[model samples]
Structures are given as C-alpha cells and as structure tokens.
Target: MTDEPDDLSDQPPLVQALLLARYTLVIHSGMRAVSEGETWKLDFASQIAEIDAALQTAGIDTTKPMFAPVKW
Candidate 1:
C-alpha cells in the first residue's frame, strides 16, 4: 500500500473509526503472534506503525471506541 495518508474524510466518522480500529487490530495480532512462538521476521511491523500513524494524522481518533459500552 502507498504510504500516502488515507483520505477517510469521505466516509462517515463511525466507518473511518472502524477501519482504523481494524488496522490497529491487525498490527496488534501480528505483535501477539510474534511474541507467541512465531519465528518469522517482523519487518512489516514498522510499516504497520506507519500506517497507524497516518490514520491518526488523518484525524481518526484511534483511542476512542466506535460503539457504546454494553450495560449488560
């Protein structure tokens, strides 16, 4: 993927948030896999970090939840 900042302004805020969250989850999963007995090189981790940074720069609030907390 190009390193250009993703133009997520056209999407609804919730959709943009969800997409960012998905990318974040993918990076986290890769990190967990590497920590849990995986021997493959993790060269892509830096790229993932860059992407997450770009997403944040694009104004998506990565720290906020997309949905309300369940009361149950």
Candidate 2:
C-alpha cells in the first residue's frame, strides 16, 4: 500500500523474512536468465550478483530455495 521499504528493520519479522525470500527468488531468476541469455546481459548478471552478495552480507540464508524459479 505504501512506498517500498528502504529498511527492513521497521517491518515485522515475517515481512523481513518474506522480503529476503523474495530477493533470493529474484537473484535465482536473474542467475538462470543470465545463464540462458546473451553475453550483453553480463552487466545485468553482475548487478544480480551484487544483490545476491548484499543479501548474504545481511546474513540471509540462501541455501534453502524460498520461492520457486520464476517462470518468465
């Protein structure tokens, strides 16, 4: 309903977990896409990798798949 949250601390635990899960899902999808797409997408892949790293730096556990791979 409101603008996207910039900080997850203010959100509830369930929200925080869900957001992290969503980010994980996006990262997974991007990875798969970059793998299948053309070389120019390397830039996009790098950005996705950065997001993935940031999520990890925040201590998000990415070992477990949260949402399924996005069917684009």
Candidate 3:
C-alpha cells in the first residue's frame, strides 16, 4: 500500500493520449483472438481514432522526442 500512484495527467498530452490508447486495448483484451484484440478491436480502434482527432486539434506534435521509436 506504500506504492505511489502513477498520474497520467502529470504527463504531456501526447504521452497521456498514447498511454490511454494502450490502456483501451489492454482493457478490451478479453474479447481478443490475438494481440489484435478481435471483437473489441474496432471499439478500441474507434476510441483511439477519436483520441487522435482530439490530439490533432490540440496541435500536439507526435514526432517529438518523447514519441521517437525506442530501440528497446
């Protein structure tokens, strides 16, 4: 119970959006046939689509360093 809470809001908007997308997929994983997450795939995909639109409107640059491809 001594663990500190991880707050998403404390992160930048792009970071928050990316984590939210991952979270949506993970939560919908139960309906999956693979990592692609079968039945719930479209649901999460659409949700992410909305998130993408919002991010675009917010003018967040996803190409920033925080979003660069990781080697590991």
Which candidate leads the pack in TM-score? Answer: 3
Off by over 4 Å in 2: 1-5, 33-72
Model 2 RMSD, rounded to 1 decimal = 10.4
Worst 10 residues of 2 by lDDT: 34-43
How does candidate 1 score on lDDT? 0.54
Backbone clashes per model, in order? 0, 0, 0
TM-score of each: 0.35, 0.36, 0.39
For candidate 3, write residues 1-72 as lDDT tens digits.
223543556678676867567556646644645455544333466665666567667664432323322335
Q: Candidate 2 lDDT, tens digit per residue, 4-26?
A: 33455654676566566556646
lDDT of each: 0.54, 0.52, 0.53
For candidate 2, what is the TM-score? 0.36
For residues 1-72, could you state the per-residue lDDT of candidate 1 as single tens digits? 333444555567865665655655554554423456756543455555665576677776545433332235
In model 2, how large is the Cα lDDT of residue 48? 52
Cα error, residue 4 of model 3, in Å, equals: 2.7
Considering every candidate listed, which one attains the maximal lDDT? 1
